[model samples]
Target: MGKPETVRLVSKEGFEFVIDYKAACVSNTIKNMLSSQGNFTETELGEIKFPEISTPILEKVCQYFYYKLRYTHCPDVIPEFKIEPDIALQLLMASNFLDT
Candidate 1:
């Protein structure tokens, strides 16, 4: 079989996340980056770099992307996404930057 479609996201601290394209596209910003009409670097390389987002926040954003994908259409109840109080502000900023 052909290789699965994926995208690489790099955080400011050099943490890299390799995730399915479908999952990554859960974020509107990422979807546009990957599928924009113009020829951008991210589209060509299948990678996005978050220079202002830290590793922990980026990790949580990635997790939320997958969680949103998995639970979006489920009939069962979806669990809340947990965030530590300390990182809440950072996560919110990252989420805004990602347009999640």
Candidate 2:
């Protein structure tokens, strides 16, 4: 089957974020989920559910994915990736789990 242009990521709260496939691949874990040799359900459906990540954290992760994609080649002009203090710990945990 042809590669999907986008992927759906579902947060623990059931919020879904549809992001570009290239952007989603910024996370090594997600890249593996979609491209691994095993028959991953995510590979077939192009969707993944993060049960440990809340909506807000997942949203930030999605944003970071796009940001990383946009600034990957341009090292000089990359902006800081901001995280709100309230969710900073949670975001870090999620990022670690996702291997982003």
Candidate 3:
């Protein structure tokens, strides 16, 4: 697969993350979107917006996504990170976003 284009993604809680199509492909919604023929042209539907997640959790989510991207060969175990309730909600939002 060639390098995909960078795209902006927004969470429902108003958190926005810039990710490559491949990176966002980790998200099932994204993957499903790509699975279709006209996904590339579908702009409005592609941005992920998770309303329940707070900024802090979205920060953590971005870090997690970075970590995962940085270490593709790493183990599957999720590292334990202390987070606030609001952030935890964001984590859950990201988890659900990626369907992991």
**Candidate 1 clashes between residue pairs 3 or more apart in a chain or in different chains:** none
Cα lDDT tens digits, model 3, 1-100, are 2224755556556767777766666656666765677545545344555566566665676666666676678667766555667456557856786674
Local accuracy of candidate 2 as per-residue lDDT tens digits, 1-100:
3349889999999998999999998999999899988778898889899999999999999999988887888858777998889999999999998899
lDDT of each: 0.88, 0.90, 0.61
TM-score for each prediction? 0.91, 0.90, 0.57
Best by TM-score: 1
lDDT for 75 (candidate 3): 69
User: What ranges in model 2 sit over 4 Å off?
Assistant: 1-3
TM-score (C-alpha) between model 3 and the true structure: 0.57
After the best TM-score superposition of candidate 3, give how far the Cα of residue 56 lies from its true spot, in angstroms.
2.8
Candidate 2 — which pairs collide?
A: none
Model 3 lDDT-worst window of ten? 1-10
Model 1, C-alpha of 87: deviation from truth (Å): 0.7
Provide the clashing-pair count of each candidate structure.
Answer: 0, 0, 8
